[model samples]
Target: MTDHAGTAATTLGISTAGLDLEASVALAAEADAAGVHAIWTSELYSMSATVSLAAMATGTRRCRLGSSILYGVGRTPLVLAAEARSLDKLSGGRLVLGLGNGTVRMLRDWHGTDPSAPAARMEELVTVVRKLWRIHEGRVHHDGHFYHVDITPTGDVRPPLRECIPVYLAGVNPRMIEVAGRVADGLVGHPLFTLRYLDEVVRPAITKGAGRMGRRAENIRITTMVIAAVDEDEEQARRDAASQIAFYASVKTYDRALAVAGFAAEARAIREAFARGDLEAMTAAVPDRMIDAIAVAGTPRQVRDALRRYEGTVDHVILYAPTLGLAAPRADRNVRRLVAIATAPRDGAR
Candidate 1:
């Protein structure tokens, strides 16, 4: 676990959307043995991120457990703070809470909350959570824009088990990216990020925001989620990755990111196909150019080279398995290979 260039050691992580608890823990254990640095789970309507991470934490010895994203809306700051404290203690301070202001559709439909002033709300959310964790002697009091916490327990209020848990913001757009840099302990790059977008857009926004706070950009750990599909059949790997990218592109929340990457027309077409319930058309709309730009696909060596493009720019590269099309064992096999390449010694390293 050596630091590189004043940054924490570049580590490999895996993202699992699978809901099966037993199998996910098994995968985490296997990844821990394989020298993977982190295990992240998503909160995409199927499973609870906290529950999933806690399960994986108990199962693995070293790999840090994370919620690739738990919607910041629909929960109070104190509740979120308590959840973070519990998870951090459960994992012995190896918990990283990746948060996001969820999509407008999901926020309204699932959580019954209007998605207005989301950026403002998210800013307060991060602030309040941090304040709650830092309460050492007195009852925490917050009269913020989104939440008010004035808890005065009668007898005893248990202080936070830990001082703080790292909060990583998940975003791709300029405003959200800037918020991440200004407030978050880290930033989780959206899966749709291309090398060009990271350099030209994401990094610049984060750096600018950090500058406002008189903070060094290096202080924020930048972890990117790279869509991956690796197989001996190189073409098949690309196909699987394309299908996954298409699914993400079809969502309206991600349209701005695609447009920023010069894929406005393609994203429009994919969304139209999606509206008409034509998944095959959506898949076809995802061009090879876009896939190569956004994902690390193809054979093992190809994936390795693709990841190297992010070497200096990112602190961690998380393998996002958009493998709804691949079997579990096959996806695991590919990720294990990718992790091996990521953790292997670079030139002149002992």
Candidate 2:
């Protein structure tokens, strides 16, 4: 609590994963009351991020609200723009519209959409959303390679609460991170990201893309998820965190996260085990070194120390509770522990 990290003031957030709708909203309210910097929701197969945030918007007055990611091709640009506008107004303009393109298999199988050029599709999608939000007149139309739109309102369209709502792009790879720099207000990094990767690869890509648009790199904020599995039983916490790391490592979509951190061999091990559907072996593949580098797990003191390592690399670090093997009660307990870790007293109190 005494600026042990000694870098900058930390802004902490919590993601409501592995929670039911009612429980997630309650957590949001609790996080808001506890003065967490932000409250984020990740969109998986269920639980609409926008919908959950809408309910959270009603209960929260202080915490900034967003999705860690809302998939790009899941909805049309107009629909996305409309949802952002609605949520922005609901939260009194505190919305950070975080978007992502689902993995190739997910895109094709789940959403029935093609993933031929996801980065390009995402860039175009952002462009269209911005243009649509700013348009106040009768006719609205866009003919893009991936999306097409033409709409003429019978009456004047209601002006958005803010013409420029902050859009945060989710990036695990350079191309997506670059798109974020070119257009997004912020970039959301994966839980597996390391400080070295952020400095050496992520930030530079942002600069390159920002340069293309004649914009400064520093203007784009960075928010990241830090998987935090807290339990008084230290061994249990480590196992839970490792399970999460193993699951992510198995996915080829997140290969860059491991590759950039020189965890390629470990990832291969996890992948092979994943193919055989051997959960235990996959979990076993994640070493303690990997856990220490990417997540915060163990006793309260140890978790806090691990979090300090991320202070300077991220503007907001969302405490991601590992849920692959956690029961509801234990997961909720971890969330509360995270809240305590985040709001603990620091020397540079402000």
Q: Which 10 successive residues of model 1 have the least lDDT summed?
A: 1-10
Writing each residue's lDDT as its tens digit, candidate 1 over 260-344 gives 7899999999999989999889888989999988998888888877776766667887888666666877766766666566556
- Superposed Cα deviation of residue 92, candidate 1 (Å): 0.8
Question: How many angstroms is residue 178 displaced in model 2 relative to the true structure, after the best TM-score fit?
Answer: 0.7
Per-residue lDDT tens digits for candidate 2, residues 1-350, read 11112246657888987787898899999888888878888778877888898999999998889898888788989889989989999999888899988688988998988868888899999999988887675577899898888877776679999869889898888998999989988888888898878888889999999899998787788888889999999999999999999988888888877888889999999999999989999999999899888889999988987877766556778899998977788888998888787777654533
What clash pairs does model 1 have?
A: none
Q: For model 2, what is the alpha-carbon lDDT of residue 347?
A: 44
Predicted model with the maximum lDDT: 2
Clashing pairs in 2: 1-346
Worst ten-residue run, lDDT, model 2? 1-10
TM-score between candidate 1 and the true structure: 0.92
User: What lDDT is reached at residue 199 by model 1?
Assistant: 75
The alpha-carbon deviation from the true structure for residue 49 of candidate 1, after best TM-score superposition, in angstroms, is 0.4
